[model samples]
Target chain A: MHRIERYYDSIFTKQSPEQLARDIMKKADSSAKKRSFRPLAVVAAAAVVLVGGVTAAAATGLLNINELFGGRISTQDEQFAGELVGAAQDFQWTTSDDDYVINLKGVTGSERDMLLLYEIARADGRPVTEYMTNIPEDGELDCAENLGFDLNAGAFKAGNYRYHYSINDDGNIDVYNLAVTDGDISGQQFYAEVINLYPKQLLSDFEAKHDIFDWAGGADTPAGFYRWGDNEAFDAGQPCDVALNDERIIGLELEWTIEFTYSPSDTAKLSKVITDEKSVVSLNYEKSYGGVWTYPLLRITDSYFSSVSGRIDLVREGYMRGQTFDTCNDIYLLLENGDKISCTAFTGVSSYDRHEKMSSFSVEIQYSEELNGPITAVDISKVEAISINGEVFSLI
Target chain B: MQGDEFTQYVRKYSDMVYRVAYSCTHSAPDSEDIMQDVLLKLYICEKKFHDDEHVKAWLIRVAVNRSRDVLRSVNKKRTEELQEGLSVSDEEPSSDLHTAMAGLSRDHRLVIYLFYYEGYSVKEISKILRITESNVKTRLKRAREKLRAFLNDE
Candidate 1:
């Protein structure tokens, strides 16, 4: 192994935990000062300030300003609805006393936008709590949180927009109070859900039906975990979270691979005599998976392919021109003993479903013995910088 | 809950929080900024920690989300980092492992850091990330494989 001790030392020297922590605390203190001056008389009744000092109160892992600005605190008692904005313009919402009616339209393709709605209500007229979108199993079931409001974590597929709505316990439905912001919006919504886990029950049932599971109970000391869900799981048309172990967490795509094969041909090499017995062969391999992915958003990049000319290129070219000229598939070059050998490569194919719902995914192609040989090694070039839903998360 | 407990917790988990911030933003200053933000946030959240799990999850999520925000502030920031020959010290690898990690995607780097550096299980990571457990495992495997490929390359 090539040890880069100097490199590691330099990197560590650049950062110190104590200094970083102190800096964070100082920023929070400043933000807290700004928050303190904001008059809370209007919403004070609806909300409560649990902590007073930013620096003095060290027990709460929450910064002083967090309570002031962490979540979208809706303290309004009156019901008001705003126009659906951004990518959710396609959905139509109507409010009823018991439920908020939502019908989506104008979806031309399979892609959709993320929707996060809070069902706000007062308990005995004192704001008991705002239950996160914890909808019951049946679509019509009433969410028994404060105000009978059904909080929804919505991801609408088959569209270019997002939608939001709310129903107060007084039977007044408001669907337009939804706010939209770009960049990791879905993550923020998920963060809200994490803060309130009561809605896990509602999501748990949804995932139970629409979610796909890996092999369960595989070992006494398990190396992994598993879950299952069905259709409504992907209904939002965007990626949403699901409770895997009776805990509500966002579903994600688990990747698996299978071998694919293709036959080789000598159609391109006209110089080679058409021998009756010595037939040229071409082989192709495809790699893919079988499972529903958890992420609500999925994207694919331009595929790249390369092969050795002298060793494997001859075989690959013969097969390509003669049988199937699919340059889209990976074919590579191999060099050995001054002979050019042909090889193939296809990697880094990723699936980003907004909601981790797909059950199975794989690749298929033709196969041949002429393409098989004792491999001395392998070579692959990686490409990074692919974006996932505005967050440059990773394609690997 | 006492001064001693608070101090102990801070000392023990400060590195974890810093690493989380570093992985998310891939910048030393930003990571430091995130750590500071998280500590203060924790200080005020007053939502009592049920156990270490709850606190860990809260810190990691806040650091990650804050770092994500930092990424958004300057579009030119990431663009400049990716451009050739900037030699930004933050981007330098601490070890061959770190270099390989720097070369990875943000998600890959995050998963690797949390799993290997912080020593969290896929389940714990899933909770901390609000992602599925299997997703964490798959990412870990792919990250390891990629790291192998990177390290083995001459």
Candidate 2:
């Protein structure tokens, strides 16, 4: 055995992991039981949950955004009421439709998080799903969930989360959040444009549950949501909503351009900070071969923050060795109320090139799994500080 | 994923998971406890895998996560647990490198084990740990430095 392998073996061979594995599996079989359900029924149950609650939602064909946003917070059910409601910032903007209207109720945030309020429903929504038969077939599910909308600002593309919706007569609300990461977002005019939607989540779940992925042909659709039997040429095995921009679906053609100027709240405050740190920026080693590690200086000419978003403007001092990569530093908004929010989700192109000195580009601080979803970061009194790359700039 | 197929995967992947857990916790008992939970999770995990590689990947990831949890929960008793659980065999390497590695943190040991012992690149390790590649590289370098520091102290 290789000496290193021997060393590792000596450390662990005292316990026979392979034997243990067999033993555990035997034990697992003795203790566990198997359960199965029809795939179509499971899909129905999931749809009911996606639309809203099961028991109450089946009675009404429309969605329950209020309940879905946090939970049914009736005073009678005081449990959910205490934790969530106060933190969301309320707004009233509804796109009108005959069957359903998409409305924005509010966005909840933390310093660097734009967490969507709830879990991503797929083939998982339960009891209420069986009752609510209005479950959208294909593209409807995409529209029902948050489809990515492009947010355009002056030169930089702003960051956005999924815009989720449910259509109903009781003013059902659909919502999405933009991370306040674009530091210079104050007074920047932006118009959110709804575009093609992809049912990647649903497709994956279906594949996992029923193994019905490739059966639904999606070659014709540009935006990836399947249309019902768009690919008769390929195989009519399953239905897909691939024709997302098909004019027939009115929900898909939300052509109204609602232009809005984003001005920070009156209580909004700003902080200024700068950094010129010289550090080993990147390492490029792939064990089969020797690799290069670069020592680059991150020169920030100016980095600023409003209460909502945080931005750090960079001025590069040229790499000493290898990389000229993009550095999307995380922008955090620390609220007065002990909550920390990471609002910087930049959709713009942010890369630092040695040839192009001090270029202002944007890259997403790619929300790690840690910052998974839309967070409750709203309704805080004031932001005490904004942290960027380990440096805290006070905003209070 | 059921029947003989499930058994085959559990037997193969569980051993990999236990090795990963052992590297992270350096405590056989803790590693065993973590292995049990992760094994049951494997037995019950519904996510279908494309291949044995996928199953191995999932198991190792779960093992790493579970080991971290054990490290955190047993932080206070860690020193006692490590000494008690790991009996130094007479054949154990007395090299300065080994000594330094022995004193290193669970995170450092984990990164080192994945890189040197398992032949996984920093990039692959980053994906498994859900951290940036730079972070994985940084951990490796820091582990080396801290290990050398231990050798110097000796």
Best by lDDT: 2
- Docking outcome class, model 1: incorrect
lDDT of 1 by residue, B47-154 (tens): 567898767777787777666566656562545365322233655554556667666656777887777656678788876665655456556656666888988883
- Which candidate achieves the best DockQ against the true structure? 1
Candidate 1, superposed: residue stretches over 4 Å from native: A1-396, B1-5, B75-95
Cα lDDT of model 2 overall?
0.41
- Give Cα distance to truth, residue A97, candidate 1, Å: 25
* Off by more than 4 A, model 2: A1-4, A13-19, A33-173, A178-396, B1-15, B74-85, B88-95, B152-154
Look at candidate 2 and tell me the lDDT of residue B128: 62
Task: Summarize candidate 1's per-residue lDDT along A68-170 as a digit string, tens digits.
Answer: 1223322121211121122232343323322332233221221123243333233233221222222221122222221111112222111122223333443
Give the interface RMSD of each candidate.
9.8, 11.9
